[model samples]
Target: MPKGYEMLPNGIIRIKSDNSMYDPWEIKKSQLDGEELTLIGRVVWAEQKM
Candidate 1:
């Protein structure tokens, strides 16, 4: 798992995209371990274009 990303108690991944304005994406825990999902890196800070 990358930085700032967390796994919930119910096996859900709580993650946010580079664009903070958009809603966070919740992925299943099993998906991360599968080939379907790839974790490259995480963005610590982002400046939204207004």
Candidate 2:
């Protein structure tokens, strides 16, 4: 998660997505527990590729 972001008790993490019409969506951290996900870097900014 980003700085100052809090993890929901339900384990749902909301992230911003410029590509999605939904914008913010819930993604349960529990769902990735078995996947062993890793954080490589933080995105400071982004631009749409068209």
Candidate 3:
């Protein structure tokens, strides 16, 4: 993560469990390389709150 990098539109980020855990909302920037494009996690359905 850097200071002024923008997140890719419709782009999903997957970080390894070995990496540090962070809230998705807290990720304002990222430093992704082409080799690190592999997905480390999958997103399922989100629960609806009433």
Candidate 4:
């Protein structure tokens, strides 16, 4: 399966690492207002082998 991180519709970020999942909702909340948010990250695609 492809692994990394993603920002959910609920304003929650799912971080996948070491076969574990972490939800950083609190941090996302603090960084955003309402449904609008600016996410900063480098998205690496597993299929591309980057």
Question: What is residue 14's positional error in candidate 3, in angstroms?
Answer: 18
Candidate 2 colliding pairs: none
In candidate 4, list every pair of residues with a backbone clash: none
Candidate 4 global CA lDDT score: 0.50
1 versus 2: better TM-score goes to: 1
Model 3 root-mean-square deviation: 10.6
Candidate 4 Cα outliers beyond 4 Å, as residue runs = 1-3, 18-50
The global C-alpha lDDT for each of the candidates, from Candidate 1 onward, is: 0.66, 0.57, 0.38, 0.50
- Please give the lDDT score for candidate 2: 0.57
Instruction: Give lDDT tens digits, candidate 3, residues 3-45.
Output: 1223455564423343245433323124444444433445444
Q: Write the per-residue lDDT of candidate 4 for residues 1-50, one digit (tens) a residue.
A: 23455767766666554424543433465455556544455545445555
Worst 10 residues of 4 by lDDT: 18-27
Candidate 4 residue-wise lDDT at 29: 53
The alpha-carbon lDDT assigned to residue 8 of candidate 1 equals 89
Per-residue C-alpha lDDT of model 2 across residues 10-35, encoded as one tens digit per residue: 87776554444435556688888778
Residue-wise C-alpha lDDT for candidate 1, range 1-31, written one tens digit per residue: 2334677888888776555565777888886
Candidate closer to the true structure by TM-score (higher is better), 1 or 4 = 1
Candidate closest to the true structure, highest TM-score: 1
